[model samples]
Target chain A: MKAETRRLTRKSDHTRQRILDAAASTLANRGYAGTSIKAIADSIDMQDASLYYHFESKDALVLEVLRTGVVLSEEAVNAAVSALGEQPDPIDALRAAIVAHAEAVLGMGDYPRANVRNFGQLPQEIVSAQMSHQRRYGKVWRNLIEAAMASGRLRQDMNTRAMRMLILGALNWAPEWYKPRGELSPGDVGRQMAAMIIEGLLATGAAQPVRRQKQGNGR
Target chain B: MKAETRRLTRKSDHTRQRILDAAASTLANRGYAGTSIKAIADSIDMQDASLYYHFESKDALVLEVLRTGVVLSEEAVNAAVSALGEQPDPIDALRAAIVAHAEAVLGMGDYPRANVRNFGQLPQEIVSAQMSHQRRYGKVWRNLIEAAMASGRLRQDMNTRAMRMLILGALNWAPEWYKPRGELSPGDVGRQMAAMIIEGLLATGAAQPVRRQKQGNGR
Candidate 1:
């Protein structure tokens, strides 16, 4: 390729990344309905036409930002679990995934945070566009939970679907209250949550030990 | 009071309720930014001026709806716990509160769901105005958790604050995926969540049980 063409391509890619960064931060702070293309362009000091040069429309740009969010979080979870070598304990892998997810959404950057914040407030078309990414991410957690259950360590009496939702719900809600400068790090929060979820709040062998015979499909 | 005056007062109150109902459903579905005063007025076929007469502005209208949401959930939790009567088991009371909260947010109506959905997207001033009610509601859970802990039946090593936040997060996130017509009722979701939280996901006497000695406030 010609030297000038190569330079132009690099500059264009940089511009696209800048636009995405701005869009992500906007979407993270203000939700989907609150973000606008004009505001995004203005934040980056780019003309609307130039912004459109990179992306077709507001939905398309937001779609890419959200898609990146899911990818980033899924990658974070996969990396954390993979870091635990071959045939690691399923419970430890689950804990690592939880911490990685918390860090991704809380400390890593705005892309994952945007996905966490906007899950329920998107247009039907946007939700449809993001469904596959979300489904794939869901599968990641499902597998983690299933692996733990298969190890015969996790309880079998509860509904696994509800368990997954509850775990993700707790982790996803971190962005609402997590402050980077606060006393607790994302990992700290995740560890505490994982402990509470694994051991529960009940004191073992205490008064009112309510354990019962395993019930069928308790949901 | 005169009968004519009383009749007019009743009619005004009824109209006020109609406006609030429309506002709650719209806010729950569309979120704060997506909901407009004009759209809310149009939905109920009320003039914009009439809406303004009932609520000074969009923020004022939304503020009332969210206020009702917190109040309803708090009341539900309070009533559920109160039904246990004096000297009831703290764990039982906590379970009742959880079930009531889930029912309020999931099955009762849109007001609580609106509060759950729009919590992170509200403007600063609205958040400020609602802080007292939220704080009061927080205190209710804190007291319940404290009661459970005092009974020496709950874990002493975990952070109580994190425990409350995780429980609320899991419950509050129900609006995102809970279908009213689905197989699980609100009470069922709450019961399953309570069971998972109180007993945890660990199988009793399973491999890799990670119980530890009492440690310093493990935040």
Candidate 2:
């Protein structure tokens, strides 16, 4: 609340953001075994001690990096779907959300990529925290899926819960194969998958992308 | 071949199969760090020395275990598609293949499950060998998807290569959330996904199962 305290808080927040960015890049390029506290600190031109002063340990830092991506993914998907506004078909909302997710993950440079690559390798101390965020993320996707199914726009007989997992798995796995400059953009890849999963690739009638698909949706 | 040599060859093959089977179950249950040559040997009541005689190293053993599942998946999907006969519909063939794959990965216990669970953690030496089999496996799925697209059954506008990757990603991720004895059988999960993917959930008019869908497609 005081002037000096406010200045310190702003600096602390900036330092945290810088550390996250550096760690995300390092972990993405180097993977779990190759990434280290010193490497991350060096990336940001900060001392290892200073880095630790802001975060407790390497596990704690890595967890924060992962949490940042998951939280961002959730918020981005929510925003994409909500932007659809009233009278948006449930199926269309789901597709836009999928595109939004794919872009957020692929478009955001290292952090989400690292989360996918090193997730299975993270120490339990970090992974447990990351998993909580992941579950919450899953919950949001599940709600969208349930809404789509309940609206009779998606199949009711099929298990929506199982379908939700498969859909997420498909989208989540995009980073492993998605090339930023490849044949298709991330939004294109997401739309392709959403059409395949939601509409059945068998038909030519997959739901059209909302005309107002938000800008910056492509990786 | 001489009778004595032929008999010995057959016995050697049997022992190799036994060792591979034991290794797959152990790795699936205990994970990479927890699994060892000694533990695999113990599971099958063989001396570690004899196990070494067959596998050379833990990496070799794990690689063979993974290869077994991928090889099985390829064969099963091939058989399913081939059984569709000369005039079979492409969508039906793809559906049957999807069911075959799901049953293989999620139904048959630990080998494939281990391949999915511990793939990211496996040492590069072991993983490199496993990946070759995976690529071959991918080729088979790609062919099916391409055939369906070429037939104008699946949407022609979507890229088949990208579609293949997304389809497999969803199916492969099944083991992470699938329960062997859950509400849906592995066969059912496969069928559900096949329908959701190939037929699109929005259509109640999608092709009904070919009733003659290959008998005993389940594990």
Candidate 3:
């Protein structure tokens, strides 16, 4: 390839990264309907036409931004669980996954944060386009949770799917209350969550809190 | 009072309720930026000028909707705890509060769900107007957590604030994924959450999950 062509490719890649950064930050703060291609371009001081030159449409750009969020979160969680090495305790792996996810959404930068902030408000087309990445990420959690349940550490009576949703629900909501300068770090929040959700808030040997009649674990 | 005067007051109150109902459903689905007075009036087949006559402004209307959300959540939680009778176990009270909040946000109606959905995206002035209600609601949880801690049944090392945030965060995010047609009712979600959070996932007498070095709770 010609040196000039290579240089142009590098410049194009740089412009793409810059556009993504702007979109992530704007989407993080402004949410879906509030964010626009024109505003993103304005933030980066680029012409709207130039912005469109890189990305075909607003949904395309925002979808990429959101997709990156799932990628980063999945990577963080996978890495955390892998760091525990072969045959790690299932509960420990679960803890690590929780902490890593909390950190990713809370402190890992605006991409994941943008996803957490704007996920529920996206248009149907964007949600559909983003579903593959989200499904893959959901599979990652599904494996961790299933491993834990199979290990017989988690109570067999509980629904594994509800467990996964409740855990992620808590972690994802961290960005809503987590302050960059607050007294607790993201990891602190994660550990506290892990403690409550896994170890529970009850002291050792405490009587089981009263429960309604036991029902079959709607498998 | 004259019968004619009393009838006019009833009619005014009826229209006011109709406007609020329109606002709640729109805000629940469209979010803060997507919801507008005109759209709300359109939903209920009222004129835009008539909406203004009822709400004065968008912020005023949205604030009232969000404030109603907090009130409903608080009332449900309070009622649940009170039903436990005097001197109930702290954990039991917490469980009740959790389930009640889940029901309110998930099944009661759209007002609380609207607050949960659009909260983080709302403008500053509206958030400010809504703060007092939110604070009071926060206090409800604070008192419950404090009582649990004081009872010596909870792990003293955990941050109460984080615990409260994590619990409510999980419950509030229920609307994003909850399906009315799904097998689990709102009460079922709440019960599962309470079970995991209060009693934990660990089998009886399982070793504590690994943690970083113990630091004093950031009181």
Candidate 4:
């Protein structure tokens, strides 16, 4: 009985994965509006009825795609955070987190694009689910910001909520323009972004001597 | 003859304006895929054929909508830059430019959303035209960054291209989550973003003080 149950579970998981892969590809290529049930079915070499058997509706299929993307993104963030466990320097950890998150998203390529483009097409329940996951993601950054603040490495005056929003806004939207072929790797872009936000454009006291000299002369 | 020509031009302009207004509202509410020529025409109480007379197709209508939004955005940025005329503080001028740009896009609301959401639907020629306008838009930020660098207000080592991308990325995508009813006004959000990027997370020279205090306590 136990062996039979294990076999059934594996088969179910494989079928679900196949359905999701088919949906992601169709949604990416044809877009939400351009894609239909029949097209997704044709791509997977399944009948339209079979596709329905897996997903109740087109919206359900899209919802599943979004859920999967968010889950994958969350997992990547969690892994990066775990890798930085007990690190005294929150800034370094945060930077690592940013780079890892960018790689995970860009690594998926068209999958991320489809997720963004079809965001509005998601049902209200699915939108809420994604938002819940996002809130969890936000907490990860917030905790890092708070940790940095506690360490005296970061400014006390900075609003952590706003800071998180700015960082996430910049990072989340990066795939829109960031090409892997560019001079900057995902890691480079991530570090530069982290530096710009963490160290800032202004010449702080810790700024190198040359930069400080320039600031002094300007004053 | 000149007066007759002016009259004809004025009539044509009015018709064009009408089509754009209808398109913006329709596209914003119904989305790109959901909007149709008949709907836009009906919004103006014109026949579908009449809308066709003005626009070659639904694609053309969307293209005009995008074109007009870009032109208006550029005009707003130019007007803001002009207003800053001869300001000695490039940082202040840059802040004003960012604020103006954010307000302009926020003011357009649905129009800008339509432009972003419908980008893939645009004809190749139209897409190139729109991108040209974007390149011009980018110059406004690039000029400000260069000016700030020359003024010594910003760090010399900062990559202006990346900085421009960061600033524009934050501001250009504001319509996605920025709410007028939120804690920050559009201008406030712009100012905070600029401050965070330009001034950085730490107070000037505060890092050293904190570090020295910790060392003194240890001793």
Runs of candidate 4 with Cα error greater than 4 angstroms are: A1-19, A25-31, A38-50, A117-126, A146-158, A203-219, B1-19, B29-31, B38-50, B117-125, B147-153, B156-158, B203-219
Per-residue lDDT of A72 in model 3: 95
How many backbone clashes does every candidate have?
A: 0, 3, 0, 0
TM-score for the second chain in candidate 3? 0.87
lDDT of 1 by residue, B162-195 (tens): 8798889999988887776767778778888888
TM-score of each: 0.88, 0.79, 0.88, 0.77
Model 3, residue pairs in steric clash:
none
Error of 2 at B150 (Å): 1.9
Candidate 3 TM-score to native = 0.88
TM-scores of chain A across the candidates, in order, are 0.87, 0.82, 0.87, 0.74
For model 1 chain A, give the 10-residue run with minimal summed lDDT: A210-219
Off by over 4 Å in 1: A1-8, A47-49, A205-219, B1-8, B205-219
> On a 0 to 1 TM-score scale, where does candidate 1 land against the true structure?
0.88
How do all the candidates rank in terms of lDDT, highest first?
A: 1, 3, 2, 4
Tens-digit lDDT track of model 3 for A133-199 = 9999999999999999999988877778878988988888888888867666677677778777887
Task: Compare the candidates by lDDT and give the number of the best one.
Answer: 1
Off by over 4 Å in 2: A1-19, A22-54, A117-128, A205-219, B1-54, B118-131, B207-219
**In terms of TM-score, how similar is model 2 to the real structure?**
0.79
Q: Write the per-residue lDDT of candidate 4 for residues A41-148, one digit (tens) a residue.
A: 787678887765556677777777866776676677778778866654677777677766666555654555566555554445657857876577667778977887
Model 4 error, position A41 (Å)? 4.7
CAPRI quality band, candidate 2: acceptable
lDDT of 3 by residue, B51-163 (tens): 76666678888888899989998998999999999999998899899988988988878899899988788878888888899999999999999999999988777778888
Poorest 10 consecutive residues by lDDT, candidate 2 chain A:
A210-219
